[model samples]
Target: MAEQLEPETILREISDLEGRIEELRQAANMPVPDLRATLDAALVELELALTALRTMGVDQANAAGRSATAETERRVLRTVFQDAPVPLFLLDRDAGVRRVNKQAAAMLGTSPGYVSGKQFIAFCDLPARAALRSQLAAVVRTGRRRRTEVRFLGREHPVDAMVTMARVWIRGEPDPMIVVAAGATAVPDGPADDERPTRTATPAAGTAGGAAREAAPLSDDRDDEVMAALVHRMDVLATASELLLDEPVFNENVAVRRCARLLTAEMTEWVFIDLTPPRAGPASAGGTGAPGAAGHEANGDLRRVVVMGQPDEHGEETVHSLEQLAPEPGTLPHTVFTTRQSALRPHVEDLDLLGVCADGQPACVKMGATSVLCVPVEDGDRCIGTITLASRGEHGPLDLLDLGVAQRLGRLLALVIRASRLYQRRDEIAVSLQASLLPQRLPQIPGVEVAGLYRAATHGIEVGGDFYDVFPAAGGGWGMVLGDVCGKGQEAAAVTAAARHGVRALSGWKSDPAEVLSMVNQALLDEERFVTAVMAGLTVGGEGMKATLASAGHPPAIVIRPDGMVRYASSGGVPLGLFEDFEVGTQVIELAAGDTLFLHSDGVLDACDMSRRQFGQERLLEVLAGHAAAPLQEMLNAVEQRLIDYCDGDLRDDVSMLAVRRQPTPLN
Candidate 1:
């Protein structure tokens, strides 16, 4: 028989065995053969010694009786848990549901399997989630039982309940488990916490209405706090809405930056707005052609567009650094975008959650992030980007209320982004269409240096109606047309195209400038749009160039002689498309060597400054006369620069100009 050892002696042997095992574990780094085998043998010996100590001097009947008692205790505990009067839940350290008793499952209106592994706080009302989360965290941090009032959201109406959480320690488990028991509390007839007013009046003691009001309890301080928070959130949203809609011209850069700043002011310490780039071509599935509703496509990455934080001396530098660091895979922002879900970490354990910064440091650590929240910027069912909020020093960790506000704000921002991209696409198309309608390269006249310039209005997004062309006509002559349609946008673009192409086609059949203008007017009569134009037919000669000029209610063409002499051609008839019988004014002009004929739209004379003073025809004449000897292209550029300076670059209309200079005949 084995010698029976005292209890103290057995405990001392166990302690010695533990010390030996620790020493062996520490020696694992050494270059020893069969180290794993030696460790396994030692563990087996420890287990056998423990068994011997338990059985030492104990009869088989007594050991069996102890085992039976342990079994009965476990069964009793299991039965109490499943049939407990109140709902009971078992949760892991992270608040993940490990198990739920039958009563708990029934209270949550779900089966145990369905509720397992889900966050317990997710079953609470949105406004209560943050508070409940804080309570659970307190219970874990202090290892003390905690109780809080929460509104569970699974029933027809929100059920008010009191939840109590206590830590349970089980052998062989590294961390304590959380046991949460919930009991139904009184359901108030008043509004919910979020809807309650900031201040509630106490009813008079004797009046009937007062007594009835007192029957239902007034809101407590917690409800008032929630109401204030809701008010603040609504105020922020109102300001954001105004910021989005207040500008007539939505500058996407300004809007995005402003929204980020707004959130930093009221929501969290740091704000990051990232966007998936707009896909080229038509929008993909579920796309609505509503202005800028082009769906954004994600290719596993997001572009950070806005970075906002507390304003300080190093704020700009910090922003620049963060902007340079795009969120990487596994980072909070990128994870949110990819998963199309919101992520709220009340305490940031992962340092690289925000990705690495330009200084080769974890972004979250560099920003001193205590909490982080990331939500998708969604367009309908598609996620276009993400908005990430971080709480740093002096700012408490973010909660579920912040998450709710951010999600709503994200939806608003998505719409703004869509509109911005839509207008951007429209501007691009306008530029391309405007380029396509004009002559790419001017046809070279025999003795003439020809140049043209067109400028769209700075105030609007629509394509201007200004058009110009310098094309080779029949009979070795050149036909030049500079015109302005009455309106802007696609409608005016159609008229401008018809008038430009019509003039080119008409000049092919008619050699006289007046005849070509008349034919163009006849075609445009049915277009329901008016056009003002000056057409010139030029022929090279030994002396210089012969120009036949015809005007259809257009600005007079100015003739600048080599000696600074300025002459304006006669004003013409009504604007084209107004009357079929109107006659265009025709003038024959002789361009001596070094002479220039300058034709311009009314926009040149109508350009205005801050004082609303126009840079009129007199200024135009002065510029032309001053630079008359310059190269034709150089002179036109000087005129445009002078106009820009006069108006401070604020153009109210489209400016179009065509200059034809007869160069001196070559001395061969």
Candidate 2:
């Protein structure tokens, strides 16, 4: 039975037990008996228990003190944040608005509660939102403050502000919250904020907004005079550019003179245009022909285009045919041409004036010229020509505006000149290619009247890939071939030639239309090009003409009867070069006296008008029905004329057509 005792009682008993044990051990003189070890261990255990109880009491007191202190601090922080004057926002890691102070909500034109959980960037002006979001993200990562001036506001005129971002820790969050604060807002380029731009109106600084304050007045009368001169120069340049660019660009020399004449009479007393030939390289940006190549090919050599002078007494400009002189180095005109830049001799009153004009001499001495501006005519990277403008007494020294206008005129002149050259070259090639490739003559189909007409596209000058041929085949009958390659240029041309000759070679003595087309298709497969074709074998006799037609992705042919009945002969198959071995279907048509057979390429129905509406197959049938009784030649003419009217001369593709009609039995 253990004694139940209070702490004081236990201590007394343990003290008495210890004294008894020690006394017994001393009487027995047994080296202070082993009972002391057990008593000492018990004493240590009792001391540990007392220390834990005292520590628990101290911890309870400190917890209560800390809770009161934390509550007071939280209340103080909330009060300060709620009353702050400037706009403020508390943002979470994603920049979501966790809290917004009253001023911030009002400034943003929204209620505080409504803004919670919304993105902070949404309140900023559209143009300023991007920068604001970047700055906010940076502050969150670095845990530092950042500031930037950008536009703000959702609906009204954008308000410019110096936005500040700070990282701060809020209660219950492990990471710091971003505090978005802003300084006073101001309008950009307004009366209050001189640095901001006004909308649309270009100011002295070339911004959208006007100056913050009114701009300082122009310095003096000379500035006013300069403006007046610039106004007059701009008007002349604009008129000249419009006139030169109107309609088709004329001769290069004529174009240069048009520009020269304006500045000669109004701005400069004399204008000297010396055209250096285009560099003999691969090709100018404006052309595809080699130098000296026929058509628009520039001669690839330098020459003087024009030298015109304006005498004070003479009202109009006079063309000068003076002998060309060797130009010395370092002259204004030579320097501009060599450097591909412009040269201005502001006050050439006493400056050496030999190389300023073409032929290494003063151009308008008779006009009493004292100033000169020389600008190089540049086409892309190469300097192609030089424009020399000499100022006489009446016109004052050239200003920046005058020089700028001259530089611009020089560039426009260069472009038009190069374009004109290319246009000429393209025309010559079109005529030559047409003459060589198209059939020169077609044989008469014994008892039938046959005729075909072809027209090139109205787009850019490109060779037509549309081709046709009528040749005698075996059995005294004739076979006709018509088709269009997929694209234009030399590639399509090669395929066109192959299809024509292939049909003739395979149809030596009345061959199958499908077999002829299959052989041609095999030859074209390796080229990776597509072709649409229609091959017809026709035999004319006393009864009428029998025709066998095969198509490879081409439009079906049409037959018109004497009574105005229209019918289509459709043979559908994949286009040539698509599959190595594919079946081609054929349509056999029986033609009677007074019946007209029509074959055509897609270009006929695919012709596009200015409005881009296609001259569709339905409309073509209507035209054919109307001219059903007309002669074969007349019918072809009518179809061509109707197509022209529908397309308004704005052709989108090449058109090819063939019409054959059996002559009616003599006066039945």
Candidate 3:
């Protein structure tokens, strides 16, 4: 009934069956049929032969299809895992590795096969095992994702791991599938330790068979944490940038102290800043030593450690300077000088200096410090000084390269210092000019208690454009103008002088506040310059204490009642030089007996602290309310002190406040 098969066809069938059997064996499974037995049995029973052949063909076709599908799936999985950027691993419910990608295997310094079935704890170092174990357990119990960091004992780097657990169904039964993605958080600073196995230089190539597949969704909730950390760092750098540009405090010792304290807090260590001269000896010998010092005495090699802070200390403080720390020949200073490298001096040992040195002193040293990082301060070709950071206790040794951050910080410090010095020189010139322009003292005025305070911004290099004048009007009342130009430096100062003289000269002709401001503004506008100001005329009369005010884009004066209530008389007007047709506005206020009025420059309100919070108008009113009853001088002093404190003792603009109090005539 059935046709006989050819010898060649039968041989081909046998070969195909043998190959399938071999593939099944390789996959750790067994084949179902033997080709020779099936053929021999078919020949012995002719009728049954047809039926057996039909069944055998169907069975072989099904087996062949399944084998091809399984192979394709395995290939696809391998391709997906290998191409992943983050390290990935699959583990059993017991935390035993089932499979790991190339990256994970590389990170663990082992082959995937060797890692398979091994306990996860076996790869992690002591410091990381406990945390990882806890996180893994939580993920498995909750069927959720868990994130952690692990430090492998033998590896030089640490890895951040994200683990998620899911139920994998196999043959209608559920099994645990743990997915992990790991990435290195920091680069290793040293050589690998002996405790970890060494990895091969090249990984074996995977056989090509199937298309790459997609990875499952990440379960770890680390995106927010990472982004927050980055944002916080960016903000810190921005604040630092603004602080560095501030002229007045940039070079001040206190400024440096604050910067060091900031670094200590951010980096979690103590910081020390030093400013030493380039070379040792007197200036005559081409060194920066103090004048008239002996050459052999190391005159020019001056050292000054301006700021230092220990985390254990209550607050930021200064440490020893280079001059104080200068040791005898062949000692600490000499060693540092000769070495020209950073020194790490641990608490238990003496200082070890590292770097290029003509003298044979060690470049890196450890003293009583548990950890220390030191770097030399270099400006171009010359070596200026050194900065050091130290930590005690179980924190471990310092990473010198990591301290390059401090070095970058030091460079910024140097720039601020240089700028501050230039600002100081300019200030001296401005102060001289301002002194020549202003009257030596306020003119005597009856029935009015007048006081003025001029406080320069804590950080600027030049004197501000703010200026005030108090002189008797031609008729009788007192004439005063408080004004500020739009900018800083010599040009602004020159304009300020011109405006002030113009007001004084104009008051001789015009007694009205609006007329005086109009004349001044016209003069400035004619000169094509910009300025803002407020002018006021105060007179005592039988009717009441009369005051007339005019403004050119300046803040209105605050009038404080004797009962401590304060009101602002702010009739607004355009700033000077903005337009040719600008008109100054005037308002009249009758001051009751014992009332006080305060006029101030906008710099007072613009002052901001390190946190960027402003000392606003509301705070100014509160201060005035609190000190209304005090003497004019006392009130101004208290307000100035509060402003200074609010700005954290560093002002970026000039402040001028003038106070006038109308005291009731005493009963005679």
Best prediction by TM-score: 1
lDDT of 2 by residue, 1-668 (tens): 11124566447445644543432333222211234333442343344345434443232335445456546645655776766656667888667889977666544433578678766655443223333544554465445577766444411133456667887654556545777766555644322333211111111311112222222344565365446545766687788888678744345757877887776666665777777654344355345444332122244233556666654333343233221533346556666766667887543432335342342223323334445788877655455667888754232344456678889888888778777666656555665675566688777766688888888877666677788888887777789888888888767777777777777888895467888889888888887578888888988888688998999988888999988889999869878877898567698898998898899988889887887889998889998999998877788788888998899877778888888888876765
lDDT of 2 at 602: 89
Q: For candidate 3, give the lDDT of residue 603.
A: 89
TM-score of model 1 relative to the true fold?
0.66
lDDT of 1 by residue, 1-668 (tens): 23355587568556645644543443342222235434553555455466556667753345455456546644554677766667778877667788887666655444568667777865654333334544554455345687767665432234567788986654444455688888777543544545423121121111111111111233575456557767877888899999877777777678788889888877777899998776565553123533233334645448888888864455676668788888777788877887778998754545568987765555664465556899989867567789999865232346667788889888888887777777777788889889877889887777678998888888878888999998877787888989999999999999999999999988886889898888888888888789999999988888788889999999999999988888998877778888889689999998898999999999999999999999998899999999989888888899899989999988899899999998887899
Clashing pairs in 1: none
Clashes of 1: 0
Over the full model, what C-alpha lDDT does candidate 3 score relative to the true structure? 0.58
Model 3 ranges off by over 4 Å: 1-274, 277-301, 304-323, 327-376, 387-444, 454-463, 488-490, 526-529, 541-544, 564-572, 602-628, 634-655
Give the higher-lDDT candidate: 2 or 3.
2
Clash pairs detected, candidate 2: 188-196, 188-197, 189-196, 197-209, 198-208, 198-209, 295-425, 296-421, 296-425, 474-509
- Clash totals, every prediction: 0, 10, 29
Flag regions of model 1 displaced more than 4 Å: 1-228, 284-300, 310-321, 350-352, 356-361, 666-668
